[model samples]
Target: MSSATQRRVFLVAALLVAAVALGVISMGGIGENLVYFWTPAQVHENASKAVGATIRMGGVVQADSVDWQPDTQALTFTVGESAVDTATPITVHAQSAPPQMFREGIGVVVEGTMTDAGTFRADKVMVKHSNEYRAPTDGMAPADLYATVEEL
Candidate 1:
């Protein structure tokens, strides 16, 4: 081959190898950086895949499901939609106190790694929306709802 062509080929090969190496390194960190979130149903469906994986499970808090031990500050509760098919629910165990917004029927995202025992040891808990948006029902005039937004 011509010297010019050979040089071009070597440069292209080196670039390709560098790209692959970069891709592998990035892939290794991707799992740790990614926060996988799923509903109760989704968790059940992908239970095997989620095993031992760190992820964020998003769901509504089940009403009257919280049982807190005052001395230990240990809490047990159901986190997910009530209509979930799987009987297996996420049991969150935190060493410290839970967030203020952590309550029954409120949306939450628990960040932790799942154990083979199905318990999630959460290091952080983020309060998400409850998906309960309601308009004023007290017979307010139609002008009231949009009054603030319209003025802005």
Candidate 2:
């Protein structure tokens, strides 16, 4: 083969190797940052694989399971499936203050990792609000639902 042709072939091969290396490096970074979403039941079912990995756990807050300590800004709650009998509840502990909308029976997605001791330690808690909107059902006008401005 001509020298020119040999040089061109070498350049192409070098470019291909560089491209493959870049792709692999990018994929490694993405894999480390990737967080998987799972329901409380799913997490429980796959507890062995989920422990020590960051995940997003979604479920309804169990009634009477929330315990907040303002002095320490510690919040602990249990998340369970909508159908209580279907799956066991998962307890979550978060050091941050609970969101203003946090309440029992509401859906929540907590981002954290499950400990070996069988509890989830959350760094961020997001309240999942319903998409459905409804007007006041008490036969009162929308304006009546809001207290007088003077009350504020």
Candidate 3:
């Protein structure tokens, strides 16, 4: 090929390589920012590795285990199945209010990192609803946000 043609080809090849490299770099950042999910059993099994690691957990809201301090908007609860053979129970604590669908017998997904105290300090709370059923009127105010439960 002529000198001019060769120069143009080289420039094109270099630009293609540079673009590929830039795309890879940007993707790497996105992958690192992505969080993971874990179930209550898995969290307990891998407590050390899960410490300070952001993850999501799913389980049914334990009956009568829910507690809320209306004055401070603080809440604490235990979630799990009634059968011991199922996933282990987990405790969650949060300063903010939970989603509107959250209630007794409903499943939930709590997103946050585990602390040394063994409490999951939830940054986000999700509710699990069955399609066949709808919540009845309880004469209570609804929450600000709602999220579907996602299994870890």
Candidate No. with top TM-score: 2
Q: Estimate each model's TM-score.
A: 0.55, 0.65, 0.60
Ranking by lDDT: 2, 3, 1
TM for candidate 2 is: 0.65
**Over 4 Å off in model 2, which ranges?**
1-36, 83-86, 136-152
lDDT of each: 0.73, 0.86, 0.76
RMSD (CA, angstroms), candidate 3: 8.4
lDDT of 1: 0.73
Tens digits of per-residue lDDT for model 2 on 35-69? 45788888988899878888889998998889999
Could you tell me which residue pairs clash in candidate 3? none
CA lDDT of 63 in candidate 3? 77
The better-scoring model by lDDT among 1 and 3 is 3
| Least well predicted 10-residue stretch by lDDT in candidate 3 | 143-152
Which candidate gets the maximum lDDT versus the true structure? 2
* Poorest 10 consecutive residues by lDDT, candidate 2: 143-152
Candidate 1 C-alpha error for residue 105, in Å: 0.7
Which scores greater on TM-score, model 1 or model 3? 3
